[model samples]
Target: MVRTCFYDRISEKRIAAEALARQKLQEALDAPPAVIEPEPVAVVSLQPARNELTVAGLHLVMPQGFNFRDIDTTLEKHGHPVTFCAKRRPAPDELTLQRSVELYVENLRKNYPDVTIVRQSDRLLAGSPAIALDYIFTAGQERRHGRATSALINAVDGDERQWFSISTIINPAHAELADWLIEFDAMLDAIAAN
Candidate 1:
């Protein structure tokens, strides 16, 4: 689109210069949004689980069905946001799986009240972490014997807003878990533009 700016300076040259400036401004405004490419973030793995789930120097030895509510509650009390993982029994088919993951997402939405859920298929692809924003919580479930895992990494921003990756899951296992952590950190770093 073309735009024009007029100056009442009786000089034709001044009016012409202002008009050219306006034209350039209009061109810039008409341009599309800049495509932002995420730069790689250096990710370090959590020390081996040894006898428990360890990350960020915290060693948690919790049983199956154990929700890390204590850790989350404490973080909330202290004014820091916390994100933690929760697991559920797998559904036998895609429709059921979708419902199951959606229920889980809704639970996260209701309970945490301050975190965001990033859902993906429970399947652990050959690649470390497959990042996609899809409704299907876990992919390749039938191929993987119905086993799936989720992870939540919580942190606070400078403004003290409770941010969430609360309902996100990574496939369980030492290597895949580690890789997921690394990639997740990269994803978060990219999101943060850090």
Candidate 2:
């Protein structure tokens, strides 16, 4: 009888312990989840300070983000960026700005598929006659817009050559296209002979 009572007591204690564990588990499940906050990101200015650079015998005031790559002789800015390149190339003395632009557009149409000319007009760059051509074309899956400006620089002492500068703003199909174009035009306006 004593053994039976002892066994009964142990079984009761075991049942109580299991009931206590189940009650604790239920309480835990009924509690609300803890909230987590995300980390903050740093904000950067869209228009940074400007920097003056001399490239291909032209003085240019470009934004801080533009980088000059010597391999291709191009100044490029990444992340919704603008690409500017100026080079002196040998050409016939009779090559006018108009003719150079016509040949450029012809080559562009042949190379790029679905070329759409936006505007082509005569403009003055650094007191010299220049031609500006704006166009849009498909590059891979993305549509790109670019402006090409060309001028024939006649040297007083040396052989005459053509001064060609092309500025292209990539991914201009978004909301920031107008702002990018404005910046590009300002950069072009600031160009002068070195």
Candidate 3:
């Protein structure tokens, strides 16, 4: 009988211990979850600093990565390079902007047999009348995209007329083409004949 009572007491204690463990587990499962805080992020701007420079008697502003070459007649961006060239000279007699653009495209086609004109239109650059042309061509094994803007402006003294052509060329597959175009448009907007 003593052995039976001792066994009963142990079974009761075991049951009580199991019940306590289950109660503790249930309480833990019902409790709210802990939340973690997120780390802060740093903000950075993608636009580069702009600088004002004159090229081929045309005053304009360009991003800081561009370097002047060919006696300040050409501007070239270093990384993902884009080339810009400008030429100013005496206006040709009886040469209209349309004819000039046609002749320019004709010359380009002669040089690059695979040249394709993508767009051509009349536009304004820095409030001055201009003809804008966009074209694509294969140079050797790589494809190239280009834009040319031609305009006529009075000389600084306002007594003589001069014609100017500003051209830019780059690879269409460049990863930064969109950004480069934005910068290019900004530069065109800032152009002024000097």
Best by lDDT: 3
Candidate RMSDs in order: 16.2, 18.6, 16.4
lDDT of 2: 0.65
> Per-residue lDDT tens digits of candidate 3, residues 1-194?
34568789899999999999999999989989767886432221111123355457998876578632222233455566677776555666687778778888898989998999999888765455789898999988989988888766554455555566778888878776756766776777765433
Q: Which candidate model has the greater lDDT, 2 or 3?
A: 3
Clashes of each: 9, 0, 0
Task: Give TM-scores for every candidate, taking all chains together and pairing residue i with residue i.
Answer: 0.29, 0.56, 0.58
- Scored by lDDT, model 3 comes in at 0.70
Better of 1 and 3 by TM-score: 3
The models' CA-based lDDT, in order, is: 0.38, 0.65, 0.70
lDDT of candidate 2 over 1-194, digit per residue (tens): 34568789899999999999999999989989777886432221111123355567999786667633222333444445455655455558777777788888888889995999999888755546778888998888988888877766554344445455555646676665557666766776765443
**Best-matching candidate per TM-score:** 3
Using lDDT, rank the candidates from best to worst: 3, 2, 1
**At residue 56, what lDDT does model 3 achieve?**
73
